[model samples]
Target: MKRLTITTLLAVALLSGCSSKEEVIPDVPPSNLYATAQTALQSGNWTSAIEQLEALDSRYPFGAYSDQVQLDLIYAYYKSDDLALGEATIERFLRLNPDHPQADWVVYMRGLTHMAQDRSFMHDMFNINRFDRDPTPSRQAFTDFKYLLERYPESEYGADAKARMIFLKNRLANYDLATADFYVRREAWIAAINRCQQVQRLYPDTEAARESLKLEKTAYEKLNLQKEVERTEKMMKLNPAK
Candidate 1:
């Protein structure tokens, strides 16, 4: 009776272990799954949309809606603030369908994703300065937008991309100017002059132009370059902001 009791308990434990394992997900109809995902997206339920789209992709990887599912997943990831996932999804889509008719849109979204990642809530809401922040993401976004405009000049997103590019350029120039100011404070005249020159050469017509000219004048004066000092001084004088 004791041995039998032990055996019964062991059997129960085994059954409990088996039941505790995860249940296999039931197969959902692909069309229904896609529709559900679309509905979730429309309702701004990003998490739910991601789950349904992922299920659809896993179950019907080669179905008619496969491409659209991938695209929607990218957008869902972005809207959900899963920027890293969104970037990975964009790269996957580009690699898998380089010649897709909607490739331009995907590229544009990639640029926007990088830009969004570079921005902080404080920067957006409080107008906090981002000049001292990392410029890698901004540079990446600029490259992406430039690529989109050059590769797909007629893309519907071209105009907006151009506008974003302009903003990024100004930001980048300002960042360089900020660095120049730091170098000036350190009395690294050559470094400061080089940075100011870079801003003037790469980001012409930007608000940073006046600052760059002023920094260049200061650096040149410190370095005893009278010719360059006079030149930069003249440029600064012509600018109304100076």
Candidate 2:
């Protein structure tokens, strides 16, 4: 009986080990793994690409294709809509290769990752009104792109980065205005005025600045503050709302 119990235990252990065989990673050359990752990427199989790329990165951290492998992995995460991983990967790459030649691109990608989080894909695709959403991600992305342009003034991505920065600014301004409008609708005059001023103060160059001035003046009027309303009116007259 004792021998049978021991044999049964050994058999169970062996079966468990054997059943897990499919989970084992095959011993492939790093180059081959990289090529497989590349093939997955080319096929637009982002999840597969990420799996292989992650395996390569884990198995051969300092391999010849380390830098490109990381970059491709970041892009795969982004394409797969796993933005948190994409962002974390970018931070890791930047930390590891601070003075890398492609650092600017990585920074730009980091910004894009945050931008992708600003609104859901369906929202952007359907042109939905999601301005009421939190603006933190947009703010983070704007700072990222701003740093990119400032640090890498002549980077190849300069032009496109600038365009995205402008878009982010507008999005932020819109968020502020939406919040201000919400306060106004609720008759929270002070809060509404504060949000309007915030938009104007931070984004005076944006088109939304004009709308902010309009809302600010309306808030002043609602509060029956003639002096404040007159001041806002003069400013509005100088920069009429478009």
Q: Each model's TM-score, in the order given? A: 0.87, 0.87
In candidate 2, residue 184 scores what lDDT? 89
Model 1 agreement with the true structure over 110-179: per-residue lDDT tens digits: 9999998888888889988869788999999999999999999999999999999999998898899999
Task: Give the whole-model CA lDDT for all candidates, comma-separated.
Answer: 0.90, 0.90
| RMSD in order of candidates | 4.8, 4.2
lDDT of 2 by residue, 95-181 (tens): 999999999999999999998898786897899878889989999999999999999999999899999989999999999999999
Error of 2 at 168 (Å): 0.6
Which residue pairs in model 1 clash with each other? none
Residue 14 in model 2: lDDT: 96
Error of 1 at 101 (Å): 1.1
Residue 191 in model 2: shift from native, Å? 1.8
Model 1 accuracy (lDDT, Cα) = 0.90
- TM-score, candidate 2, is 0.87
